[model samples]
Target: MVRTIILALGLMLSVAAQAQEAKRADVEALLEASNMDAMIESIYAQTNKMFAGMGQQLGIKPDEQQLFDDYMNEVTSAMRKEVSWAKMKEPMVQIYLKHYSDKEIKDMLAFYQSETGQSMVKKMPAVTQDSMMLSQQMLQNFLPKIQVIAEDFNQKLQAHRQAK
Candidate 1:
């Protein structure tokens, strides 16, 4: 009886492990089909562009442009290394595993392998870029109002601290 129980338990564990591995593979396939690596590259490019704009706005001297560019290049390189798809794939897989079930992942994989899904994947970078620009513009328009509110909050906090 004891040997039978042990054998059964081992079989169950093996089956569970196989299921997990299969799920992980499906999730990986989904990510690949979705072009997540390209998405990460797009994000890196956008970040580099944003940093370049900030450098220009900061009025780096013409002579210092090279220094600023070098610094920005280093920063972006570090970011790319840290956020590369190779580095991120496992964590991203874990996140998907946590949030999505095996069936859901399989469904997504099927969709991503389809023509419509491929089209969405191809256009995602542009859609993301436009959305980011719209959000940034909205934030810029709202920032002065936020600053005023923050200033008022600071004054109130100072008064409260003084009273205390």
Candidate 2:
């Protein structure tokens, strides 16, 4: 009788696990509708562009470009492997399920599959890139002002120390 009970419990657990897996798969489909995979891939291309500019800023020699490219490729490959859909699915599903119902998930899927949704997905990378450029420009403009403030503070500290 105990053996039969244990077997029944095992079957129940298996069914529960299958149900959880189905939910995760549903969540994954919703994420795919939003072009999550493409967004993740775009990170690699964006980083490569940033590295090219950084090389110039850091005075990296032309001869070292090949080495940088090789290393960047390997790093990007590792990141791609690490951030695969399987790894992302659990956390994303948890976040989605926490905040959304079955109806909401369906609603989101419908919206994301629409024309406006497609346009947003297509433009997101460029929008993000432009926003980053604007932020960098703003920081560049503010940096000299920050440096001047720091220099003035240092001089005041030196004068105060001498007076003491």
Candidate 3:
């Protein structure tokens, strides 16, 4: 009976593994069909634009061409290290299998291949740039307040330590 149960469990696991493999292939195809390369280009453009704007506002004028090169190089290197693309793939694949059927991802990929989708891909940089600008502004506005809080907290800590 134990041997029979073990065989049955192994079969169940094999079937589940096959299903997962199919789902993973479908998710990877969907991700690739979404024009990931173009999306990455847009992201780089957005980053450059954001940094340029921030540089102007912050009044730090380095050589533009060298700055661009260095920035892009640093970003590329960081992405290769930080993203852990293989690990990231798992959660995304799970989400796809959970929320999106293979048919849905296929349809979405089809939509992304359309003219409107292409336009969206083109225009996303500006939207992303604006968001970065907003974030920079918020950080600029909040830094002083954050510093004050930190100072206050430090004072309290010091007082507590002295009492102790």
Q: What is the TM-score of each candidate against the true structure?
A: 0.90, 0.69, 0.54
Name the TM-score of candidate 1: 0.90
Which residue pairs collide in model 1, if any? none
Q: All candidates' lDDT scores?
A: 0.95, 0.83, 0.73
Model 1 global lDDT (CA atoms, 0 to 1): 0.95
- Clashing pairs for predicted structure model 3, backbone only: none
What lDDT score goes with residue 59 in model 3? 61
- Evaluated against the true structure, the overall lDDT of model 2 is 0.83
Stretches of model 1 off by over 4 angstroms after superposition: 154-164
How far off is residue 139 in model 1, in Å?
Answer: 0.9
Q: Write the per-residue lDDT of candidate 2 for residues 1-164, one digit (tens) a residue.
A: 99999999999999989976776677778798888878877776787777667767877788988887787688777877897766887788899978887678878888788999888988999988898789889998999999999999999999999999
Residue 160 in candidate 2, Cα distance off native in Å: 5.5
lDDT-based ranking: 1, 2, 3
Model 1: lDDT of residue 55: 73
- Badly placed stretches (over 4 Å) of model 2 are 1-25, 156-164
TM-score computed on alpha carbons, candidate 2: 0.69
